[model samples]
Target: MRGLLLKLLFSLMLCLFILGTVLTAFVWYVFNYSDDRPRSSSHPIRKNPEADPSGVCKECRENTIDKMVEIHSHTWKKQEANFKKFRSQLTSRCHGATKAIVTQVNTPLESKIVYDGEKRKPLVVTPKLFSTFLKEQPFKNVTWETCAVVGNGGILLNSSCGEEIDSAHFVFRCNLPPLDKGYEKDVGNNTDLVTANPSILLEKFEGLMEHRRPFVESLSSYRDSMLLLPAFSYGHNTPVSLRALYTLQDFNSPVQPIFLNPEYLQSLARFWRAQGLRAMRLSTGLIVASLALELCTNVHIYGFWPFAQHPHDRRPLTNHYYDNRQSKKTVHAMPAEFAHLLRLHGQGVLRVHLGQCASGPR
Candidate 1:
């Protein structure tokens, strides 16, 4: 009888436990069922886009206005002093650069990739197995007087700055941008040196893995300009860049293919970092402009603006003059860089040409 009583109590306990578990699970399901079930909307909700950090923001606009007012109100003597200071800062390291650039293949051959922030290794050029036609920097003998470093920014569209751009003794273009179509009037036909981003190799030429004829044919507009590639910037870019050289040679293209000295890039990065730009890497246009400051007696930059809207008016413009490729917020602090460039322009250290160049010889 006592055993039967104990078993009855045990059965009652088990029933109670099962009931409690069921109740707890039901409560949990009631709370979380909506999370699992999808909510289908009849009408889609449109969200407003966030502001671009790469472009001029509200604060930048206000600051630019303040600087303009300050410049307009200031005396010529003060501006001259500022310009002198700016010139000193830019040319402090890069004037008549020799060791900074790789003049010989042996300089970097068998050398580890020490340039830039990344620590990469074992990158070498074996002449016995790997042959390169590119021997040295192409324009080592030339000294440019008036140099123009053109940005591919959409601000150059309809600006008619081509004549002004061509007037420069030397011109630097970024990313092997198209010079044909209707862009010649704004971006100019002259090209001294154009830097091709490694990304361009992958995207446009399929990393030059096959059918390099398209790549060679694309250089028709550039015609005898030097093709500068950041081949050693990263170890992966080396093969594609070397292939580009071979392609040019096989077709005997007039465009002289040259690779950028990683050391030159590293020094350029350090220069910008000292100027308060904490970026992963400096933009190609900015690097070209920095080189221009050292190489050219007078520098005139066109299409360097990095704002979505016109600084004077609030009208939006295309991100690039060539294609409507939407730009994302980048590691490069473009607005701050532009502001620094504007300040330099204010002091007459360089000329920043924006929108609609006046016709005739610039």
Candidate 2:
């Protein structure tokens, strides 16, 4: 009877010990893992710098790269913590690293490229045109530590971001904007890749069918930068794209003209559409920024403001840093695209510089 009593007492003590262990674990989890507790230095509140209610763009004005990652909010803290996951979530659909441009490998001689603008019209890869394609993607098997996508917004007129922009491992520009002509200090002279719209060829150089010297001379400033053209985006873009390429070849210019793959573009459009971007077409700035997000470990976008007033000082601005010629609003949803970029900035996936840049290497 004494042995039975001792066994019962031992069993009761064991139950109490098990209950005590479970309670201790519950308390530990509440204190250590609960959101109410203070986050470590590694995780921060993912706040939108633009949406800061204080009227001061404190986070946006930071000159140092380390300071740029400080603005966060609770909603995006998880995304801010896992950049690789965010990048994969964004790029896995478009695959810009492998398929951003047309290559002989990606576009075989007989394959057809459906125009993104006119879905019914498709351009077959003829042997003559296939010869112009690079053997592989220029960005294939390459990743940059940092990248800069420079837009033409007039907010950059005197931002003095050149030194910082030039410091990036790779730089992307849109619409073949002039890099020289005293604009280098603000816009930078380094151009790893620049996009030229077909309309620019038709309007600026008379389709490159006449005064080819001026066209060739204008391209001299790019200095071996790969020129990307939307050759198959629309049916009308094909001739001018080809003309621009042929002109470069005829002059033996160092600037290499490449074609934007329509397939990749379509995929990108679908990706953006899934993200709630409904526009007639994605702007050049957004396209390059998205590409940068995929190719670079750290992506910084400059001059992306779509407003008429300065983001900081509320001063009037031009449509572009180089010229005030306004764009056709019906084509692109600028505000909507900027909203998406702003969200990405909030999530710590990328940094969007709306005001003047800090004058130095970043």
Candidate 3:
């Protein structure tokens, strides 16, 4: 009986192997002979040119290299010499490092906003209400040796700047960026202060009308950082910004929401306008950079390139480090902002990280 069972098992294994080999041979024959067609030498395959989502054609993209104007590796040493020198040019008197611009008394209510030209006379923040957000009040000691302002520009892709960025005494990232999903190496994991646009609240959280856990969970990555918002900048921004503040407060989140003093933003705009930058409004990155100039002794900016092309290889890049969403050119004069930042970089006021960050010479 044992010998008979062994013979039957051996026969089954051989049958299975023959069947697999036959199926493999049949599939190979079908794939190879299925699409036989006579090739015409004169009618060879023609490939379409690559399309640019920015709507620029190949010719236009080719000429963009010639139109590149900002100071770069090719031009920084040569062009910085031509620009006039200044001693730490600053605009606002209300940076955290020097003085607390918005304590209980100095909140600017009557100052006109940058975009709407309306006075913020109605906005108010009570001292009792503000003190409840953070019990520790860590910002009481405003002096920081070094700070990293991480902009969401696509130039940061492949920068490998996570370790360098996290090494700073404080790190500020604009618009809540996903630090997970393989992005931590390029964007870093630390967050001391993060500024949020009212539009982000509306678009991402549906104005926080329902299911608040996602919003609260997102704030967890920042740990005990401050959530800075331009609550009084625009008239429409007030409602949504307030909702965000409430969301954090209601959840007892570690992330504390801080409304930026409108007067500081106004002063910052006026200061940059005087510096020869032309735009409807300065970008958040520029605003953050301007504030960084005052808040820390050494400010290192990452991911701030404005052009679609990479600085080194000149390949096309997305509008943001996270996504390729099309940006409005008319809303903010991005090139002009980049030009000013480039000039500041030339002046040695702050360091801008253009390419990948390395252990040596960074």
Candidate 4:
């Protein structure tokens, strides 16, 4: 009986080992070798000249490249002209109001501050210095006003939006995730600023330095146009990855760092509180810092909804993006704030483009 039991135990262990090995291999294959083709055969393939011009035959490829270049150059010139006009309009309307608003919002907060362990200091520009920075060198000739904000929706795949997104005077991307593999066709190579809060940097980079190489390689494709934004407070987010990113200047594509003044944040918070809308004040610091980039002109926003919407329907969620999926009862939605954004867009305060979705969340 004892001999029989020992044999059975050995057989069970062998089976378990085989199962684990097979599962590991399957995961590795999925992550490393999966193709970008649609999972279902029912989905039809759309012909995109930029993605695959072979449909037109190989001989005309040179013509296609030349046409793309010519189109980009013309669009760039037109965008510059529009940006200058937009800046003039903005200055005429809001130049005085903005300063008064900033002063009114200014409040002192007794909060401790911390920085990532990286050696570079934050790039905090005073109003005058920021304006000067925008006016100098490369920007003197290049106009960077009105911008179109693009999101990473799969809907944008083969949607003929690459040129439209690129036409923006300044384009913004958050989290700086790679556009390689599955996303290359969606997010083309024309990103201007890579935005992040310190928390995002810390979470993605700390203790995961091995991941940095691929991220850096993807970003190197846009070396000349990387803009980094700092978090407002340690309390909002205190991620170790932020420090890791700061230390990664050795990566081929180093980002130009920009810091937000804590005072600006405190002031914004005070203003929101005075309005009796303290709950909506959490991200005010980020908003104020972003607005200050009016010096850069033609600011457009993307992927900045307060909450994630349905993956297919693009409806807003009541809970946060990272919330547990199993807990259905606890989830709640916030449409009022989204309505406010629409109102602001209508007032020309900011341009907010919704991703293509047939319905919004109820």
The candidate that achieves the highest TM-score relative to the unseen native structure? 2
Each model's lDDT comes to 0.74, 0.83, 0.71, 0.44
Tens digits of per-residue lDDT, candidate 2, 149-210, equal 99999988888888889999899999989888888988898889999999999899999888
Displacement of the residue 125 alpha carbon in candidate 4, Å: 16
lDDT of 3 by residue, 204-268 (tens): 88988888889989888899998887777777787787788888888899987876666676667
What would you estimate as the lDDT of candidate 4?
A: 0.44
Clashing pairs in 1: none
Sort order, TM-score high to low: 2, 1, 3, 4
TM, every model: 0.76, 0.77, 0.72, 0.46
Residues 1-362 of candidate 4: C-alpha lDDT, one tens digit per residue:
99999999999999999999999999998988676645676766766543675656333544533443333233111245544554455444434223212121231122223222222333243453332121212222344456545444333543344545566666656446455554444455576666555554555555334566755554575666645444434433423334334544566356554443444445444543443443433443234323433454545444334333343344444332223232122221222333343333444445444443222111
Model 2 pairs in collision: 45-72, 45-73, 46-72, 46-73, 47-72, 47-73
lDDT, candidate 3, residue 11?
100
The numbered model that scores best in lDDT is 2
Q: What is the number of backbone collisions in each predicted candidate, taken in the order shown? A: 0, 6, 1, 9
Clashing residue pairs in candidate 3 (N, C-alpha, C atoms within 3 angstroms): 109-120
Write model 1 residue lDDT over 1-362, tens digit each, in one string. Answer: 99999999999999999999999999999898955665569744433334545444566566765565455343322255665566577666554245334545436455445545445564655553234534555545556778899998988888899988888889999988888888899999999888888789889999889899999898888899988777777777777887888889899999988766676777677777787777777788888888777666677888877866654554677889887696546667776787777777777677777767885333
The order by descending lDDT is 2, 1, 3, 4
Candidate 2 residue-wise lDDT at 306:
76
Show where candidate 4 strays beyond 4 Å: 1-143, 150-160, 182-185, 207-215, 229-232, 235-246, 270-293, 296-299, 304-337, 355-362
